[model samples]
Target: MAERAAEKAYYRFLVLFFNCLLTFGSYFCFDIPSVLQEQFQGNLSCPNGTHYNGTGHNGTTECVEGLGMTPEEYNLLYAIYAWTNALVVIVAGFLIDKLGNRFGVFVFSFLTVLGSSVFALGSHFRGTPYLLPLMLTGRLLFGSGNGSLTIVQNRITAIWFKGKELALAFGLTLSFSRLGSVLNFFFTQQFESRFGIQWTLWGGTLLCVLGFVSAVTVSVLDKVGMKQLGLDGVIQQESKKVRVQDVRQLPLRYWLLVLTIMFFYNGVFPFVADASKFIQDKYPGYSQREAAYIAGAVYDSSLILSAAIGILIDYVGLRGLFAVGCAVLTLPAFALLAFTFVPPLVSTIWLGITYSFAAASMWPSIPLVVPQATLGTAMGLATSVQMIGIGLSNVIVGKILGTKSSELKIPLWRWQNMMVFMLANTIACIIVAVSLNIIDKKEGGTLNRSTKRSPTEQVAGQPADTASLLNDVDDERSIN
Candidate 1:
């Protein structure tokens, strides 16, 4: 029995580790162009275009250094991804539920790798007329895979962690995934500085290949666990097939939660996507390296604290209260970044805290309200809605910032558009979160229960369920 337990433990950790790796490449590659914003926007190649002063700390923004693309073109790279995923994720979710997350993971991971290669290929021919078209094409593919894989991650995570440590597992996965974002911000510049644009991008693409490998490994591990550990019933229960008609059964709170997710994410992710350039435009005195690292703090702080916050919420079970708090905290962060010249680190740290807090709390709440059978479809619907907000936000942001003249020494006006959009979203989030909390209370406080199960609740070392790899955990928890 001890040996059997050890095997289970081993498979569990391995699957979780590889599952976390599945998103690393996608996150890292997503932000590459933003990190190299200057390089991509440059009109001239770096052979003599833009260079560090003799001190190696300051760069001449006066020099145009890379592909001669306008700001609107630069922002299109991100907007395309959001637009494509707004629809694809819903279909992907249904497929995951009908088929299984394991297949979803492998297939989408491959799509990301393919997308990365396409993106790299586009960047390789920097001077060609085809450059922008190729790049946008690449982003479209990448977005489809990235959004779908995220749903897969959530579904599999629900199955694997279930009632116990669900929040922490999410936090850990988030921390690991965001680590890619952090790395891209910090290293993409360094890679470009040493290797030039084409190679640096291809280097990031190589990481996508690694993510695909991890996906393959995780699928194998998941399959092995099912066979060796008697987890077939668990898989069937958690990932049971469902039809579109079943979506009508999702609760009112789920829709509210989806609204909250949509509004809340719009404030954060689009901000991050454009952060590096936003920093340089606001603080012209800083080097690209400084701007990139400062931008990175938004993700770095989350990577450091997300799991710890998850553990706390798991033990205490006040995710709704924390959800409200998370939205509230973001208000000031957006306020400071938009209005004051105060050091950006303060605002970024605040945004990071809120991002980590919500990652731990708001997301795990989805399983509580939605039935297990349709969790995939539910996640898909939420993600589709979330992408709609993000996509529209990106389009708005691109339009506002894209038209600005590159001649300005400091474009202070740049922050206002993002701030107005984010502030409005935060206000919306606060209202929605409050509603979710009130309604959750009326619905018996399902989201407020500690996820820890009593010994009496254990059955076959996993939560028992119906149409739910996720519901069994919910089944054992009482609202009181």
Candidate 2:
């Protein structure tokens, strides 16, 4: 019995380690440009008092300035990633459902590696006319693969850690991914200076390779586990493909949650794309490294906060209320950044906390409102919708910042406009959260209530199979 327990714990950790690896590279590459923003656009230095020439001690401009792209163009690099993700994520999700998690993650990891390679090569395209186009292509490929990674991760996590443990698992997964983002901010710029921009980009490619290797190993483990449990048919059965028309069968709560995800993420990630630059522009006294850390402070905080929030949600079952609270706090967090004299670090930490809260509540709620068979599709659809908002919003903010922008200074009013838009997005998310709460109450109050059956089991109207369900009773008794 002791030996069996030890083996079980080891397998669970192995599965999670690979699952987390799947997104580690994605998150790391996502923030690479932001971390190296100063390297791209040069640094702001105020050596003599609060007013000095904008030129800094940092050496050699990289992509954004080297290519001579406007703030809009620089932002387009980030925007293209989301735009491509919006286009491909749903299809990728469908494929994952059909092909299984292992294959799905493997394919996407390869795409990430190839895309990062192309992106790195594009830096050398500076002398050629195809610089922007090549980089855009690389970003699109990267985004295409990246968009589906999280969905696949969630699907695998549900398969392994369903029920009371699901939320905590997700929180742990998020912390792992956010670790990549945090480390990117901490090290990418330093890497660029010590090595080169190309080497830094290639580092992302290497991380994807590590993720791919882990994924292959996990796939084998998944198969072994299924066979050991005498549930080898479970994966094939769950792959019963979803059709386009079946989307209508998704409950209203699921769609509402989707909208909340779209609006809520738009409020956060678009701002994140611009955050390093925003800090450099607003707080000239700080160095590029200092700005990267501050910009990433929100993500840094999530490393610890997300798992705790997830556990709290699992214990209390106030997913909607927690989401609403996240949205509400976002208003002041952005307000502090936009209008107040409060240090950006304070507002950033607040925003990070709220973002973590929303994420913890939001991800776990998907499985509750949809059948297990459709989990991948639901996650994919949500990601696609959310990425659409993020892509468009990034461009909008970029254009706003680019408007009448001087080489040396960006006026506070331009940033004010961007803040207003973000604030409005959060407000819209709040309204959606309230409506979702009302609908959840009217439907069954499942978001805040415990049950004796998995939502999937209820949806299928079938008795839970002990062999197939992975301790289904424990899962059924909890809500996130």
* Candidate achieving the largest TM-score: 1
The positional error of residue 181 in candidate 2, measured at the CA in angstroms, is 0.4
By summed lDDT, which 10 consecutive residues of candidate 1 come out lowest?
458-467
The residue ranges of model 2 lying beyond 4 angstroms of the native Cα positions read 1-9, 41-65, 403-408, 450-468, 471-480
* Residue-level lDDT tens digits of model 2 in 1-480: 532431375777678887888888878988887876544443222233232122354632222233345577678888999988887988887778777887787788778878888888887666568877888898998888888778888988877766546678889999999999999989987887777677898888888777777678777777676666544565676686556666678889999999999999998998887787677677646666777889899898899798897777767768888888889988999988888767789988889999999888888888777877777888888999998999899989988887443253466788888989999999999999999999998876767653234656443542331112654423444642
Per residue, candidate 1 scores C-alpha lDDT tens digits across 1-480 of 643551455656667899999999899999998788777777655566566321122433456567766777777788789888888999999999888878899889988988888888898677788898898888989999999999999887887776667888899899989999999988888888888888987888899898899888888877766655555565566565578998888888899889988889999988887777777667546677888888889899999999899889888888888989999989999998898888887888889989999888988888777767788888999989999898888878878775554331335686677788889999999999999889988876767766675534433332322123434433544442
For model 1, what is the C-alpha lDDT against the true structure? 0.80
Write down the TM-score of every candidate.
0.91, 0.89
TM-score for candidate 1, residues paired by index: 0.91
